[model samples]
Target: MVENKHVLEISSVTTSDRGVYTCKASNRFGADICQAEMAIIDKPHFIKVVKGTNTVLQCEVAGTGPFEISWYKDKKQIRSSKKYRLTSQKAVISLEVSSFNSADVGEYECVIANEVGKCMCSATYILKDWQTPLIS
Candidate 1:
């Protein structure tokens, strides 16, 4: 026996840690190598937009892809339609709601997932409409 002992450890991990890692060892008559991939799954975040206007709800996300991103309204899943335009490029996802009206005032959530995991975040669209006060 040539001593039975080996150790391989990763002290800390960050976004930069998401990549392929390889280890290789060799002897005069033999060689060995191994590789693995590390993927990161991050949650979506809310974006600022104006209400009562043609606004695009932006969901800025960061994670490994190809990802399946979806929008939700009042806890209900929303599908792409003429009025609701959905687009995604890189890590940014958008839901275009044309002529945002009073009926559109509600909570909306953005969810994204890959083969690894799923993450989501929500934002509330509120409109402060004032009514006239009357006195007798």
Candidate 2:
């Protein structure tokens, strides 16, 4: 029963869970041990924006690849209802608001995960009256 690595799925993993994970595999030839270290992290920072203007929210990370990005509002998944556009390049991920409004005011999230580990980042923006700010 030789294996390369072990897979573990956990929700709400925190810094306290940071430690080493060991996998033991034995075969007729011999036995081997594979160890992996992981550290839990806090959510991403929020970016502020104004109303009636285009906005881009970004999240950056290290030591991860092939991630999955998601947008959220007040902690809920941002639905794909044709109001938001998200794009990723290499390690950079961003959310594009074509037409900004009060509805776009909230927190956005970028979730990254690879075969080795997973991480998440967050961004928050508020939509203010862009025209009104210019008057004052």
Candidate maximizing lDDT: 1
Clash pairs detected, candidate 1:
none
Residue-wise C-alpha lDDT for candidate 2, range 21-116, written one tens digit per residue: 887888899998889898654443323222222476665555434455566767777655567777666655667766666666666666666665
Of candidate 1, the 10-residue stretch with the lowest lDDT total is 127-136
In order, candidate lDDTs are: 0.68, 0.59
Clashing pairs in 2: 44-121, 44-122, 46-123, 46-124, 51-128
Query: Over the full model, what C-alpha lDDT does candidate 2 score relative to the true structure?
Result: 0.59
| Model 2 root mean square deviation, Cα atoms | 9.8
Count of backbone collisions in candidate 2: 5
Please give the lDDT score at residue 135 for candidate 2: 7
For model 1, what is the alpha-carbon lDDT of residue 26?
82
- What residue runs in model 1 are displaced by over 4 Å at the alpha carbon? 18-54, 130-136
